[model samples]
Target: MPAALRITLTTQEHQTLKELEVAECVPRRTKQRATALRLNAKGGKVKAIADYLGWAQSTVRQTIHRWNHHGLAGLWEAKGRGRKPSWTSQDWEALEQWLQEPRSISSRQLSQRWAKQRQVFVGAEQVRRILKKKWRWKRFRKKPPVPKNPELKAAKKRDLQTLKLWAQEDLITLLYLDESGCCSESPLYYGYSPIGQQKSISQRSRKGRRVNIMGVWEQDNRFEYTLKVGTYNANSYLRFMEWQAQKAMKRLFETGKPTVIIHSGRFNPSCQGS
Candidate 1:
């Protein structure tokens, strides 16, 4: 066999290798290289060091060669040493522009669009990786509703605040009234199940009659609600309001404050008599 490759380390180089060999933060391969260099400096042969470290003999030789040429820098990898990304900055810019559209796009659709636009086919997995890692984008279930007239919404909010201040001073009793309806057949969409099993629920009927609720809430945490089997028409709502008004009159006399009812939805002129 040819003479065993031997390298002599300077005092600084030896100390650096000693520290790197024991360092916890460095990569395993870097630590291994440091250890191999230290051993070689102590007159350990290539094959012997390779056997002790469980590395191929050629790998040890390459490490020694790199250390000889590049010194401490050879212990870690250099940048741009692996496969390059296929997408460029221009491609990402185009993707950003595409994302500005009013609708959502899935990774599969994005990949297809990219292939169509650039003639470079990329998989959905790759597109997802780019979106998550490069763009730092996430998918959401729903977007919040935006008002048609923002200025009008702001004006209404300011009016509500003014009413709230009046209510706080006992100048008025502010009551919020609303109506909602829900079907009994609405099924629960989510539940937990044992691993690898599906969750399910049994129901006698898949469809059921709608239950309508008309409720009023006072600023003082008071609540009154009336339930109906079907919908609440103008006549039924007027009757409910009359009942609430009669109940409010008793408290109005005791508190000596005028009651102001606030309804956010459409109001029928027929209910004005109540």
Candidate 2:
């Protein structure tokens, strides 16, 4: 079937293996590996070496190959080679069940629970690694809030997909509208100016009033924004909507394309001046 594995050892190599095979404090596994190599060097057959050492023929062949490739280093166990994982299939099944509980569990808490039930001490880091590498679990910043109406939410999501398709096909332009305010006292912390000049911000008053900004952004990067001296009110918002309507009508008249505007549905009391 295949050629028999063989090895030839130098005088110095044989002496070193012999000493390692009989060293009082050497681990038994290392001694076995050393003896297997020594026997192969002395013309012992794989099957005969395995029978003598009570190891499998495959193990003996592996020993000969390893010694040929790695010399003496292969006589010791390789890094990350040792006992099989203590967590069995049943243990993983139990872990899966634990994860399905309504209440969430932290990795450290789960490790403690695992130690109590299985009588084995696995650290939180190890538990996290297994969850990520083996189970493909991910870390999320926070859980999303449960919607009050899930069916409506699903319908809205489907509608959004349809809208995106329409926008991609140029059937309609999609725009997003948002509003926020900032105070002059909190100027941008950083800005670029000439090499010798420090950028300066000038305010009309020592304590400047808030500047309200309303902006509408099109999916294709076109946008319009307005800055108001005071907070936005219902009348101001209505005026902005009217301006957008006029712009959309002009675009439709010229390009024959319709437009759809989307905004966060949350109502702001300030928007109504209430």
Candidate 3:
């Protein structure tokens, strides 16, 4: 068996102990537990009190030491731990304002500006975090426009509305017909470029010419017909429409009457100089 030791608390210290035990705040609970163990028969050894209270001996000893040194206020949470913050709250506010300005500044440029204005040197990652958390900034990429022409915008909107109406009415005979040209010898541009050398150079295959492709889509199904004619004008477009109309008539004759929607490039009467 180990030697037994007795511990006793002064009247004033005992009163302080009781006050902590009944205190409503959470911080007081830790202090109370420490005090209670110290006043017990184990003789207030740092390790003994810490073991009884299920805390680190250092922590138990520190609490008593702090209480003795600085009184109750020292038991409160500290302002911060480790090294002090290099940037003040005011510095963060200024950084946020600078970011909000309409200036195309890169991360490096922004970091330099922050270091100059706030007198605090920070890395790109730290700046990014502060911007995101405080200013709600995020990384974003630009998207290309789907339709560049104003007239095409109106036309596409009209086409979509027409298709939606046809679908809602259960019109199975509706079709979307249009034509596009593809150059067989056209070279492909795989990547994107912001600026600099190589401008106005056409990337097209040397041997092949552009081929016009007339296509139609209906209810998620598509049909395409290609024209091998040398030069295409208004006459060729009408002729293509006529051929499609004849095919539609033949199909209707075999089956029943079906709603046929015909769409084409704008028609010009003077294409053949008629």
Per-residue lDDT over 1-274 for candidate 2, one digit per residue giving the tens place of the 0 to 100 score: 5588888888998898899887756778889998888888788888899999999988888877878788788778877878678788888778767765534366788789888997657898978766753343333222233434888878988988998899999899898888877786644333222233343333222245688888899865788988898767788888988999999999999989998987854424355352
| Per-residue alpha-carbon lDDT of candidate 3 for residues 1-274, written as tens digits (9 for 90 to 100) | 4343334556676676667666644454556554644555335666676677777866765666566666556556676755666888898777656654433345566678888877889887766544543243333232332325889879978977886776567653677776556665533332212223221222222354566666666666666575653435577767876887887788678766464665653422346662
Computed on alpha carbons, the lDDT of every model, listed in order, comes to 0.75, 0.74, 0.58
What ordering of candidates by TM-score runs from best to worst?
1, 2, 3
Better of 1 and 3 by lDDT: 1
How close to the true structure is residue 266 of candidate 1, measured as C-alpha lDDT?
43
TM-score of 3: 0.32
Ranking by lDDT: 1, 2, 3
Q: After superposition, how far is residue 231 of candidate 3 from its true place, in Å?
A: 25
Cα error, residue 167 of model 3, in Å, equals 6.0
Clashes of 3: 2
Candidate 2 lDDT score at position 64: 76
Would you give me the overall lDDT of model 3? 0.58
Look at candidate 2 and give me any clashing residue pairs.
234-271
lDDT of 1 by residue, 150-216 (tens): 8887898899999999989879889998877687654333322223334333322224568878888
Per-model TM-score on C-alpha atoms: 0.45, 0.36, 0.32
